[model samples]
Target: MEPLNIQANQLILLRLPSQNIKVVKVEPGSIISLGKFGSFRADDIIGDPFGFTYEIDSGMKLSLVDNTIEFDEDDQMGAEQAMTGHKITATGMQQLTSEEIEALKSQGVSGAEIIAKVMEGHAAFEHKTEYSKEKYLKRKKQKFLQQFTPYAIGSTELIDIYLDKDPTRIYNLSPETLALALNMGNIRPGGNYLVVDETPGVLVAAILERIGGEGTITLVHENEHPNLDCLKYLVLSEEERERMIKTINWLELFHPEESEPVRTKTAEELEDLKPSHRRQYYRAKQREENHKEILKRADTCGFDALMVMTLLDLPTLIPQLLRFVGGSRPIVLYSEFKEVLVETTLALQKENRVLAPTIMETRVRKYQTLPGRIHPLMTSRGYGGYLLSALRVHPNRAVNAVGKIS
Candidate 1:
């Protein structure tokens, strides 16, 4: 595999000091104006590697910084200093007027120099405790720093961005639950998967990343056209996109029909046809062939795994989807509400088509991990969502097992 580089026309994630992220297209010779922070020519960072931090200033130059750090430990120390103290006086602490701050910004001073000047003018700088002092400096840096990190956007980073922007867009799915579903389904390269993704396309993109160009994802969507908007951000070549992803409607998958026969032509006949007619003839033939293959796969019932992330009623959805998955293959379902999955699990249990249906949820608690002030953060997202997973199996009546009826 080639090492992924920041290429022109590809989407890259820019993470700001304020912990806000922006998805930007890397177009060469274009100016990327980050508003107040600063602006830089896209050419400066076009060929650079992903996951590097760059500081932009009025000089229109880019300075690279190595950002590899242990995030948990660093986050804890930073949080402890910021939140483990009494609220400081919002007014009268800093003597620099708004005009002075704007002048400094316009002058294109380095982030450190600006922060130092702000601290020097702060009337209560000497009175603050050591931890409080660190907190103030950090806050000032976040506000005035003209710095942004360009990270290689992957599933987890994309999820964080969506969660912050609009939870409803991705059904409030979390990285933890997404990981669980992938593991439970045993998703890997070269496997064929049946997916119903109403999370728009995050789930489909994640699967594509794991499977690469080898595996196939037959995505089932409710409407006539599939909603895979998230795939627009992926930096995939045309060949990879065509080789890995395929889409089908729910009605087509469930009630497939033989496609109309397309007219055929000999090599001589095709050469003699008009250019436009030849192109149309080839397209029709390809569509008919693809439809036949999809219908065959649907009828064969041998998908490697079945993964679904949708808001539709699961109890009614799962049973219908399970029929397309082969025996002993994993079936994983994700929902924002546990109640939704619980109902599906009960139905699967009653039908005896799945083995040991289980509902599981994973939550991550962040903390301020200083030696003396370590504790959970005061505010965090309350839910990370839930997963209902089970394996499709064949029920044998020839020999009685402990849980089987004779």
Candidate 2:
């Protein structure tokens, strides 16, 4: 793993107290705002390791928070309170007004102090059940806490940030589904892969992590150019991208020269171009040659695996890519709806082109794991969609069993 310190100009995820995540580019001397929560100088956090949590002081200064810190009010509340009935009072549930809270802010009150003040003002706070009081305090802290945690960017972080911002963009795919897809696809280092990723690039990003930038990925895209926008979130350089990633559109893959009109220039013609134009010419020629080489290899040797995550009609796509997938290889498709994959699965079965076509769904529900307080967490992600997977095979061949007809 790379050193986990915050780097200058690196993209990082800042998770705020309100459970809202912000994608920020850390530039020295600049300040990133968390709306009403607070803002901190980017330089203040530079060089810190990944797991430190920072609390913003009134002067915008940052101080490290203890990892084992607990709320004062919460620590005082006992489980016995959970069984106690409410004691009704004329002051009602809460008496703090917005104007008063703003005045407290102007007085430079910290978030914990503000929470304590609110608890004190609530006439029925102690009378309420422990769980109810805990919820109320937590909601207030989420709103008022001037703290944030910075997370290093990775496949899981990108998926979470993207899912939180726009689930539809990533086919509502979850981490569990990505894991399952990768396991089923058998992605590994130094393996050739054919993929069609329309989650713009989330699926491609996942594959790269598993492959470890050691193999080529022939990403067949729908548009004129592949949407390699994943580079925005990933830490790939131009050289690494050129080495491990190959992109081809439908036209470029199937009708190579017809779409590009590759014109060969003689040595004499190359000498006629200016220095800058000559450099550009050679780069374009190299790209063309590389594309041809990848296509030829896929055609002759076939890819080790095939994975796709797109809304395109699968019936049309499977035939084009399956031919390039070697026998006994895996083909995996991800769809937000099971209905979309049903048609694709049946067609593959009818053609006898694959074995054991299966549709899988992985749902994860987390719980509070503290021994006595164990139960499901109140909020959990209900997304991950579905996967259709099968192994490519040559139906024309008959195989002999190694074991004696078990």
Candidate 3:
């Protein structure tokens, strides 16, 4: 395996002190501006290892630093002092005016120096309670810190980026739901999967990452072209992209014999064509071969697993999709609402083509993990979506005393 580094034109996640994330394209020789947090040359971060937090100096030079403050078990007293629920008056806390702060920013002072200046100018610094002081310091640090952490783009982080920036782009799919789909589908290296993704490639990207270019994904899409827009953010090489994923229209999957007949040209006919016409003819021939392969795969109906994250009606969709999945293979379906999965589960039970259909939901609650002040955050996501999973099976025939179709 190769050491992960920030590569040019790759999408990297820059997490600021305020915990806000920005997805930036690393273009060498370009300057990436982070508003008041200051700007740095893209070359400064390129070739650096991912997952390192760097602080920008007064001269705009980058230095590796540990941005997170670790709270040890021995710091219980300090933690208690920091969250004592004491309120302090905001007035007279600092004497620096907005103009003076702006001047300090313009002077290119380091974040630490600027913070120290503000702290020194605060008139009521000694008057505030310890908890209030700590809170103020934290808020100010987040506001004035000229630091950013670059994280390697993976499925989880990619989902987080979209969740923070535009949830609609990934169809509001949560990380927990995404992970459940992969696990319940039993994705593995060298396996063949049938996927129906309306998340526009987030699900597919996750699968690709899990399989690590060793599996095949036949994506069934309703549109003329597969909407794999989210794949643009992933750092897949050309060979991996070409070898791991194949797209087929839903109509084509349902009607495999509808593809056009392949056209073959004799040597005489090829010799008579112009150069451009000959190129066009070869391109068409290659496409025809690819199309035949896709149709052949669809006709086989023996995918190792089936994973779906689409808005299509599941009760109708799952049964139809299961026909292509091999016996005893897993089928995992994801939806934002439980009612949708509940209906689909009931339908699957009636079809008897699946075994032990189950509807599952998972929710993750994040806490503020200070030593002695641990508690659930004031705000958190309400839901993480639902998963409906079952194994494809071939039902045995019923008879009075011998096997027969019932």
Candidate 4:
């Protein structure tokens, strides 16, 4: 059998007994070890272009360094250092049975000792972030307790719970993390992009950080009254804020017959207009200005492309959305579950105008266990969602199997 190959920008998912996680490995094996559960050779992990799963038939030998047991060493020294932070190293991973892990837990063993035993097998473990020894101890305790069981929730349930919480327990991505995802999406500088997202400030903040050149962004919402209160946290320069174009009540603009047309006086016809007619024209012009102001906060314009990241029912929104994105563009949709996204994928396929739309999922896994443990490793967390991408084809072209309108 051939060894698995890993690729850049690829979404990787690893499911462990404790939890599932998703992550995009931007760099090859940069200190990604499971701490004590087990470790892998990062150099060996990077060269696999195709992903594979395997178990070591026998235990592998790891290089070890001796530590001098000295008296008067500050207990806080190592704990304080952990406060800075540490990365996972792909070395020193040992596979133990679950029975071994259970025994340690039953003995009231400390998590620090467990993590240390797992880490001692690797030499690449380094501290790069600021960490305090005390905080590190607390964190390790949490990690030990968190490994007890896995928590699973549906997408809707998660959204409902998170939205209601003042200080949510959910770990959401920041602008930097979102930037990483955007790069995975192949977003480029100086390109017009369309965005439909509920988190206005967060979405825009991420875009500003990654977008370069003179590219334009069009933000869309359900109505002229955009719920952009969350955006207040995104501090933007006066000049940069002015560059954004907005549109409000997206449904009204895209839905036909929602806008009423008013007659305008051409130069040839103006000569024949009476004073009374001229008065009506001026009044209509005033109304237009008033309407524009009411929607100003939510209205953006001059979009060279389209993207939908907002919260709307896909079944109802897709038809209306199709009208906005004529052929020759790309539509990328993100979902937390395969079920919610499968409908959209099928809808695009029925349209028969989409190109080879790709559907994929991603996850990140961490292997960690204590010395003399039975379980080889445990999973850390689930960190990815589903992705469906399709290109809008123009009228005069062939559509692919996944629905690409050429």
Best by lDDT: 2
Candidate 1: where are CA atoms >4 Å away?
1-3, 66-109, 120-139, 258-284, 298-301, 368-374, 399-406
Model 3 Cα lDDT, one tens digit per residue, 1-406: 1239988877888888887888888898898988877788899888988878888876678887743552122232554566664233335555788788778876867566667677767868768765675677777888877888988777888798878977877768889888888999999898888889887688999999889779789888999889887777887776787678877787667775776655798999999999999988986676556556655654676888989988999998788877788889999988888999999999898866898888898777787665544567657776578898899988765632374345
By lDDT, the better pick of 1 and 4 is 1
Q: Tell me, by TM-score, which candidate is best.
A: 2
Q: What TM-score does candidate 4 get on C-alpha atoms?
A: 0.45
Candidates, ranked, lDDT: 2, 3, 1, 4
* Candidate 4: C-alpha lDDT: 0.45
Please report the TM-score between candidate 2 and the true structure: 0.84
lDDT of 1 at 324: 80
lDDT of each: 0.78, 0.80, 0.78, 0.45
Best to worst by TM-score, what's the order? Answer: 2, 3, 1, 4
Worst 10 residues of 2 by lDDT: 397-406
- Decoy 3 TM-score against native: 0.83
- Tens digits of per-residue lDDT for model 2 on 302-369? 89889999888997778777888988999999998898789888888677678889999999887643
Error (Å) of candidate 4 at residue 268 is 25
Clashes of 4: 67
